[model samples]
Target chain A: MNKPASLVVLDLAILIDMYGDDSADTICPALSRFRSEASKYINQLQHAVVQQDHAEIARLTHSLKSMAGLIGACQLMEWSQLVEQAAKQRDQTMLANHLPELTTIWAALQTELASSLLLYGSADA
Target chain B: MTLTRNIHVLVVDDVILMCDFLYGVVNKVAGCRAIKALDGKAAAEYLGNERIDLLITDIEMKAPSGLELAQRVRSGMFSQTPYDIPIIIFSGNAYREVIEQSIAFDVNDFLVKPITSAGLTAKIQYHLQHKKVLKPMSHYAQLVADVDYAKAIELPTEDRAFSVAIVRELPEPKADDVDQREAASKAKEKKEKKEFLVWPEHATTGYFQLDRRMRNFAFNVSCFHNVFVENCKPVAIESERKRACEAADYLFHISKNIKQKDNRRDFWLLFQQRLDKLQPHVKELNSINIKHHSQVLVLLKRLAYWWMQTCSRPLIQINEVTHETADE
Candidate 1:
């Protein structure tokens, strides 16, 4: 299989180092938790965007920014910062355009994390 | 300097993982103990109970955020110590507004997240080490108030904890007519004020006329910082930069007063930050041309050299005093 592009996909090695190993004991559970909550974050972000609630957008993005930073999700963290800044400035167009990228990243992140967790689970078993 | 074998540091963050990471990083310091608080409320509780030697906190926690925590510590709202506890703000977002808030709230150091253990430890050590050398403004102010440079320069057998306590207590000089309106609007209401540097009646720095110049220089620089940082006015950039450079020259001329009279090194650390904080303000000078910015940067570089010499070369004077005393 072709190697995934370095920047776009998660670096499992870095994730393991940050979260403490790829096993169910470490990265798996954190990824699982992130996967479950990311959708809610995305949904709230979308709702906030639709309503043009700048404060809500800023609040949601700030949370995501911190979480993304913790998990070593550089791309998501950076995008969240941009959206957060835009929200702070009350730039509605900027918020609307970047709102969908949050879901796209969430979808990609969930798929990658789930596959990693499955591989780790089978290996452990 | 005598130090407690183990220093206690409190790390506050709302995220469990970030808290754990910071705790781990701080704990790695050989003689340091690290405590974790998952939110601002818990951090305050820890502050109330624990004898924390240092604080490293995130800005975006639950109520009473890290910025608020820093302000409380500075304002002595916590009632833990008369001296300000060293605070380092470790946040993921170093937004411009956050930096401004951190400065306004009196944070010692601001470090962004994803910090290395080495970087964090270095900042912790730097602040703590400086804290050991500083004395309350009352000590130095009293020495100056009495005009006793001889006693101020004495190399004590035992280490003293006081040096410059009322560094922040310096009063605003009477503003120019143009500045009167701007000053009132930008001024923060003072809760309590004290004289920081007082000269005794008929006090002279050997040279009679030079005394007035030195006093003006110090007051002008202090006023410049107060107006620039606290008042959030960058339009006064050109004049402020000129005053800083002029202050540097004045500091050079009366270098003796600073050398023999100023016992603590902590002011220089703050001075360094003040110099560094000039960058953002310099950037904010949108009205100024590129040439003006270039000139300001060059002048700042020169002023930094003068500032370092003023703070560091004084150690040589202290050594000379020690040697003279030894000879006697």
Candidate 2:
């Protein structure tokens, strides 16, 4: 039988360390909430980018950066920081260029986080 | 049998994930009860009504920034919690400006973000075990008021002296001009009202009554400095110096009135010694000649700087008291 795929984008170790060994109960629900919040922020970022509302873009990206950092999504956090800086500086071209890649990373992170939750959830059972 | 009380810590962040993560960490610690607030406004509500022993907050948020919340707490704006409750401000950046601002606002401690479980737990434990020495509310409030007055009276930097003199020398206005000026001044005052209080480190004495008196002294000294620099009449300069001397005398009287015991007694003794050193300068100010304006200014500046340093120094030395004793 083939082994399950390991998480690449999301670091579950940090959460495990924080919540301790039997953190499945804590981790699963927190990840689910994070996934939902990330989706809403992504939608808002897209709208802000389309409208070229730099302030809203900055604010959303900043929140996303902090949230991503909390869950050990380093790449997502870095991308969010870059996007936030661009938005703050009113660098329309940079934001337009980098936002798509940021979204791609978020999508990847969501999948990884979901799989990790499932793995931990089943193991706990 | 020994009794134990649950340590209630208030964790505030705008992000739900961050708040939950902090809550998890705090909940893991034995004898700790973690209460989470999603934003500063929520935190304020909790602080106003709940029994929060410690506050851990993020600096950046949607509104009422963590620093503002700290200011409100330190100023005794909340009804339930003690004004001097330990506040730990955490931020992703930990930049110089933020650190300086946190110190100015009198937060107990600061932490940078991406905190590990061990690091945060240790910080929470440390703050829980130790309480900070704080000025009485009356003193802190007066320091805030003095800083506000100082900021308001400060002249703009570009040709400040000339501009101030121009404004001061303006002839009496017509009745119509008076109404127009009053409208403009009111609008300016409204705009200048700050969202939060910032106590300058130099102005804080860490004692309620002493800080108030010392700030009054500084304000008078500042007035003297302004008039001296502007080459005002000798009479005006003398009047300002007299006011400053009167402030210094008040400081002396208030210092005697402070009733202290234990560690507070030690702080009071140190303040009295510093006051002894300061008295000579205040006396010198009274005798200094107006023609020797530079000498007078030097004395005023020295006393002001000395007063700030004395007040800013730590009053209570934290003993290595064990957590067990702290709980009792």
Give the winner by lDDT. 2
Task: Residues B1-328, candidate 1: write the lDDT tens digits.
Answer: 4346788889998766567667876887767899999889988888877677789998876678887676556555554433367889965544334455455455688765445455677787788787633345344334334545434433221132212211111223466786785756454222102211122222232333344554565455445444444444565744764674575456445543543555333433333343343344334432334245454443333232222212211011111211111100
Inter-residue clash pairs, candidate 2: none
Q: Which stretches of candidate 2 lie over 4 Å from their true place?
A: A1-8, A18-22, A122-125, B1-3, B142-328
TM-score of chain A of each: 0.78, 0.82
How much lDDT does each candidate structure score? 0.54, 0.64
Cα-based lDDT at residue B19, candidate 1 = 76
How well does model 1 score by local distance difference test?
A: 0.54
Using DockQ as the measure, the top candidate is 2
Candidate 1 docking: what grade?
A: incorrect
TM-score of each: 0.49, 0.55
User: Mind giving the per-residue lDDT tens digits that candidate 2 earns over B208-307?
Assistant: 4565776577667767777877788989989988998898898888766653322443234345546766787878987888788677755654554344
